[model samples]
Target: MPVIVLEASDFTSPLFLVRTWEVLSGCITFSLVASLEPPNPLSDLHSTFRIFCMFVWCFFFTLTLLIHILSIIQFHSLIPVSWKNLTMTTAVLGALMGLSASVVFAWMVMDHGGRLTHTVAAAVASCITFLAYSSETYVLRTQAHEQRGYMGSNPGLLKILQLWGGCNMIPLVMEVVHSQGSASGLPSKVLSWQLWVSTALYGVCVLMSLVTVVVILGDLAGRCFLPFDKCLAAFSMIGVLLYMVATVICFTKILQLKELGNRAPTGVTELIIMETVVASITLLAYTVDLAFSIKLLCDRSHA
Candidate 1:
């Protein structure tokens, strides 16, 4: 008797690596968005919630990577043969990723004082998300008639995603254009105001996400929801909530220091410093995600 290695094609034989990676990349994004946490290089610098969020970020980050692996391993040689299927899958993933990315940037959209960069990013992303969601809705509806309205899709959250996406940049965009008070200081002028706005927005998004989650959980045992789709929605939501909380903390600190002047921490200072570190890490993550998604999709043809 000879031992044989199992190939992914035995099950869903049409799928292949690169195509699969694309789908996985978008799917993983949901968890990654929910898992963002500010990293602390200063041993003493700390926020309990922030720490917890970081842990979440790491966890989701891992999950995202793991899904990439699954996509690679499972579809290593099947996806390319069916270009039509592959294209459809890529579109679905893009739409999902766009929707999830909007959640990822919710904090940016909610920033008070209103940075135009954030506003623009949010707005552009939201349009992307809505377009993707609408397309997804059409696809889903075509496949399953029972999924009318998410069983508890909070209109409020949907509204926020839309409203926020419509305008992402306010102060930042203005500063870039006007150069008014764009000077470098321990605490940037725009930072505090942004913190306040982001914090408040996160607070609201959290509430909306929480309500939506409860509804999802309640319906878990019901007949309508698909396990994978429901799970995707829930996980992506976790990322949105984390951004909200972290952003709120940034806002609160700024407001507290508003009374202190130059003596203590300011919101702008904190975000600038914090984001400075996280930006590199997140960029790496995004690159990895893109490589996994696109490469996997492309690899399907090689097999």
Candidate 2:
């Protein structure tokens, strides 16, 4: 029979406290948002944004609770992943998603006139939840040097940022594609190729980051035939080139739409603009990762 042990110290840890705040604030956010009655009928984009925020809150709440329970029971070892890496990944992802959700929910409420007390409260709670998650990320990051996991390192954290940026680009790109013809008064086919290329680039970024994170967390980097560090550098270089192409495509398309007198619905133009910004930021992150990878390689060669 296997013995089950409880670690009281885990409950007192800063990470645990941060997670507790995340759970509570997340609960408050969703609860308040659920009670809100939109003063006016919401557009598809607005409704989607609201639902996304609620989903983020609910999903993180459940995930944080489960993590806490596993820690309390000291059963995290049963999972094949590095516990530190898992927590760090969760913290980074949760912080990004929470911040995005908070911004979206707050924007939606304000756009709807911001008169409802519950809606405003929900937005505030969402911000608090974002802060909690951010704090958790900071705490985890500060302890990264103490852990052997790759996720505790700078490049590993940047990979999470790249992943988040890629995820953000996908939906925004999709919305841009869906609204292309109607928004710019041009045929969808006119920009179809460009949009599809952007989508493919974003998808590739997400796929690469996800694969890298999985390899690190699963401790499979060493078993790979190719040197993991070199592979990561190659991927980062590819990501940079792809994102550069994506950025140019995005901006050029946006300029063309503007020149054509954009007729995009409330949030469609914003979505396009947001996609461009995310692509640029993701590019910057990839550039930094490439630099870090090079530095690591140089250091190893010197040794």
Candidate 3:
């Protein structure tokens, strides 16, 4: 068992963490210069903007999750079609997933005093859970495909899974995820066991992140902090980015395969918004984490 500890300073407060996190994570913490706050440490420059962002993030997260169920809906033919059903499904599921990840990351940050062992274990557990979700997402899509002959068969599920979770998960199992390659060759259909480039591209990123996490944790307790946890922060944040990129590539392939073309998918923009929110939330989580790591390294160096 091991645990990562946060050494907090008297002046290093939550307000500082949140602001620094927002800035480093890419939000324009500084609002219009002509605003009325007078550039105070507690300025409310982006007050309205921040609130809007938060609302958008939560909505996107939850909607994505719910939309996961829309896979069961049908939309096509001369009677006029609306994929809104499916899009909404994705929104719902995406939201749920976003929320879960947020809770876990926030909990980790807020309870930084916990032992390194717990943090390490929790991180591993969370990753495993996500992997499981990935598998289920695949299963759901596979099942929806066309409900094959057998009692458990659902071809429709597979078809949609290939659309939703299937694409990204494939990269997880195959390439250095989050890389840029044509998404057309997904799910890594092994043609005589020869690996697909799409698979390899995404798999490498994933493998690298996994190794980074394990290596960093190996010294969790002994290392002074900053660098060790920075490794964790890097691995985790990079992994998030990897997921976003891979998922996009996967979606493109699915769309192409389905001949979705330029017309925007019903909820694609919403899904993107949701993913962006998750990215922001993730940024906050890791910023708090590695920032503390930075503080620790600085303190130790001065000592």
> Per-prediction RMSD in angstroms?
16.9, 2.8, 24.9
The candidate that wins on TM-score is 2
Stretches of candidate 2 exceeding 4 Å from the true structure: 1-10, 34-51, 185-195, 257-266
Model 1: how large is the Cα RMSD against the reference?
Answer: 16.9
lDDT of every model, 2 decimals? 0.38, 0.79, 0.36
Q: Estimate each model's TM-score.
A: 0.29, 0.87, 0.26
The Cα RMSD of model 3 versus the native structure comes to 24.9
lDDT of candidate 1 over 1-303, digit per residue (tens): 233444556444333333343344434433443333333122222233223323423433353344345444554244323222222333343343344344424433343333444344434534443354445334433543233333212332232232232122222222222221333342554656654664454344345434433444344334445543343344344434444454454455446556666854323454433432332332233234334434544575586
lDDT of 3 by residue, 236-259 (tens): 455446555645654554555356
Q: Model 3 residue 286 lDDT?
A: 36
Preferred candidate (TM-score higher): 2 or 3: 2
Per-residue alpha-carbon lDDT of candidate 2 for residues 1-303, written as tens digits (9 for 90 to 100): 575765676667897788888888888888877775534423333444566677888988898888877877678989998888888888888889888887767766566567567776787898898899889888877763766256767788889999888877876676677666565577767678757876787898899999998997888888999999899989999999999888998788778668766443555666777778888888999999999999999999999
lDDT of 2 at 185: 73
Best by lDDT: 2
Better of 1 and 2 by TM-score: 2
